[model samples]
Target: MTRFRLRSGVVGVALLALAASSCASDKAGDGGAGTGADGVKHGPGVTDDTITLGLITDLTGPYAPIGKSLSQAAQLYYDEINLGGGICGRQVETLVRDMSYDAQKTAVAYTELEPKVAALPQFLGSTTIASVRDRLEASGPLTLALAWAPSVLGAKPIQMTGTTYAIDVINGVDHLVKDRGLKKGDKIGHVYLEGDYGDDSVAGSKYAADKLGLSVVEQKVKPTDADMSSQVSALKQAGVKAIILSIAPKQTASFVGVAATAGLKVPVLGSNSAFAPQLLATDAGPAFLGDFAVLQAASPLSADLPIMKTIIAGYSDKFPKDGLDNGVMAGYTSAMVVGDALKKACENKDLSRDGIIAAHRSQNAWDGGFGSTMDFTDPAQPPTRKTYLLKPDPKAAGGLTVQKDNFTSDLAAAYPVTAG
Candidate 1:
């Protein structure tokens, strides 16, 4: 496992105080420490009554459904918190922007939000976030990324709410070998987008294949390439036992629908972002119900877990027109983490960005009423290796059912995820 080092607590606290003091303007304001009249220390995006966070997401691209889901669920959580007196006597507000899954737009969004928000809890894509990672490392807010690529874990302030894409693939492949009757020397097909998400997932598949004596036949595609007839044909000719997907919902639907029509009946598995609840209303819906599963870090909104019951009821009531999906669970959980960190910072009386980061790093065994507890002490490693394997279901809430809850195969647990 790879690890990134943060500054020592004492040094960080002092430096943060100095930076806040040096940057503090003489004029009264709400975004900087000592800028307000209350005498309580605050940071950018913070005031006497509100703490503003940024939500940079894709609302017009392939990931729009997920972005919407995340935004809505997070808002619901924040509303609940505000109703209950909020964190540190302040209401949480979000400065939202639609980056459309574009890196350039993300850069612009970051520039616009960086000076006004205290933190970011929903920066949506690996590629988009990577575009601005350098700036983030230099002076970015405490960010909770919606992406799962291992590379995102390198930044000090950026944290993922769940396991990486690589671990998800490792667990998915392990299930294929142990439970799906795949044997040594078998061929497993991988169709992925050509970026951090795909590359990391392929890395996991290769590692698991090497351990299980299986061969990986890879097919890389661009996000714009929606038709999967050729890729499906190639994998069919390769005679692969199963296929792993690390693309978006459009690609997954096309691949599965094409494969089904091509007479290739193999187990199809996907990363968390590969499927959306809206897909169940499409022509590919039937194919998704057959031999297709997804790996998720959080439980579905329909999960039997107690917290899920509250989330589902609240979400249905809050967003009547929107459909429930895994993004709802993911967004709510990420907000929960952010709220916890803010509360800790309040207790320390240092709600500055540095204080928030420090508070987040101290969490070692935190549970958000999810199935698994996470350890956030190590920013380099995923908080947990346990993942849920889910299957699409037309009748289920979130349009999916959990096949394996909080499962971690031996291979996944043993794999060493390193920095690039």
Candidate 2:
């Protein structure tokens, strides 16, 4: 397995202190250290009574439904925190904005809210974050990344909250070869997005294909690409035995439309981002019934695990009529992880960016009530990631049937890490 290296704890702690000191002027006051001794909060967006977190997302673009679902899920966690008296004697406040998934808009939005929020828990999309990454490091709030791209992960002070797309695909293709009955020399088709997320998945798929002696026929689509006929048509001509799809919601539907029309009879594997339950309600629904599987970052509420039960109840309470989804679960788990870090930082009386980062980095094997756990501290620690394999099941929550739990792929370990 590939390993990541973080600075030593002593060094990391010192850096955190230094970073906090550097950004102290951005805060509202000067009493920001060593406890609630002075009963004043020193960080931007942090006060004795409130800690405001920011969210940048697309609520009107093609991914609008996803954005709304994510926001709702995050709100669920924040509501719980506030109801329970909040962190460090302050209520958690979240300010959300619709960037429409545009990079320029994200930059504009961040500038307007940067000084008012302590951190961002759900800033999304690779392009949007990349546009404002450097600014985030110098003065922006300590944020949790929703995008697991290497670039995003490398952007310090914006750490990843889940497994990266590359690692997730590395493990996913293993399921295809080992468990899904594929052999060496079998043709594999990769239909992916034209971005860091899709490219990483393709890289992982290629890595596994090479290891297993499988051949791959690849196709790419833009984020806004509504039709995938040309891409799917190429895969059909390639005579692929199985497909690895890393496209978005609309693209997934377009692929399904093409696949179903072509009479293709192969199982399609996908990254976590590929599965949008809304597709199941569309005409493409039948195409997903038995032929599709998605690798997920965390198990859904259907596992009936105690933590999942809480998630289901919490989600129902807030949006009683709406169904849960991967987007929602992603938002929930990410917020939970960030919330844990914030609470921990509060314990140390430094609710600044460095405090949050240090608090997150100090722990190992932490689960944050999500059933699955991973270490965020040591640099050399191999990503001990587990990808849940889920197939489409109308009866299941989010229309996905959990096929495997805590499944780690040997191929995932073999794939190289390019972001260290």
Candidate 3:
């Protein structure tokens, strides 16, 4: 196996300077005001003093830790922005609701927040977001989804910050073949959740397998399924050289632990949501550190980038006791996207729903000082095809270290994102 080290440069300073320029530009005038007196066309959830956004997430479910971290980081970002002078001369206020990871609850939360917010900054859960997307398309507040399945990209109003689940898996498989000695005709097992998240991951694995002359052995499980003893047994019996996991952190802990016990010591690659920092405190931590690597579109909180310093400083000041994780970066990045769009809308003097959507689409090359630059112009495709491969490390920030920075596999770059 080849070791890859983290590299840092002056990119963070450039991104900050650009952000400062954008903030300075906002001083020209409060652009998103109502047409009554300011001659500006304002949208819903916008007042002269405030701009409201929504966050519907899982605060009391299986993904509670990630949800909480994501929401906290968003709040931290907005707080910093508000203190620095606010966007469009208005303070950003977030309306938060916990859906407990249930689709029905998510629908209810969306119904409640749809009328009051200008846009949604963080809507978590793959299935939950899909349930309320029909309502979003008919109405209009542009929404940023925490989930990243390609299937959910059909709605114009909904957008994702990073690449899709399938893209990450494709890159991961490619990495295994190129760096980890995986060869053609070797069997790679995938244990995935049975919804959009897992299905999309499987799609990428299959695509890579076909191109690389490898075979994928799949095992599908529901969100609630945690014990991976059976799955590991099956994969071991199948003689898989590597394994892909597209489930949550709990399943990740279970799978790695079970695999360790079953002597199925193969290279394990996971999706973005697969591993959480909290997992490092468990008995499975060693297994995760040794054999598992996760692919994600965002940089971890411990990254050496200058933007991360800002994010981490703000988060530490606000939530001193909160454990650090990639969720903080994910949440802050999502807020950056929303803030950028709002700034653009304000500049256009049209803060309406349609105006916000138009402003967001204009960001063809958005660099948030994390991961890769994204292109938001095309709704049919993912924002970017690049992903980072990270490994669990107790000494690292967010309990993970970058093994490969902003990587785009040839197979991943060529794979077309198709909506389900």
lDDT of 1 at 44: 82
In the range 85-177, model 2's lDDT, one tens digit per residue, is: 988888777777778778888888888667777778888887788899889867666676677677776545676766778778778777878
On lDDT, who's better, 1 or 2? Answer: 1
Ranked candidates (lDDT, high to low): 1, 3, 2
TM-score of each: 0.89, 0.87, 0.90
Q: For candidate 2, report its TM-score.
A: 0.87
Assess candidate 3 and give its lDDT: 0.81
Candidates in order have lDDT scores of 0.82, 0.73, 0.81
List per-candidate RMSD values in Å.
9.4, 9.5, 8.3
Q: lDDT for model 2, on a 0 to 1 scale?
A: 0.73
On the 0 to 100 scale, the lDDT of residue 151 in model 1 is: 79
State the lDDT of candidate 1 residue by residue for 113-225, as single tens digits: 88888888878877898899999888888888888888788777888888989999999999998889999989999999898889999999999999999999999999789
Ranking by TM-score: 3, 1, 2
- For model 2, what is the alpha-carbon lDDT of residue 208? 83
Candidate 3: residue 246 lDDT (0-100): 92
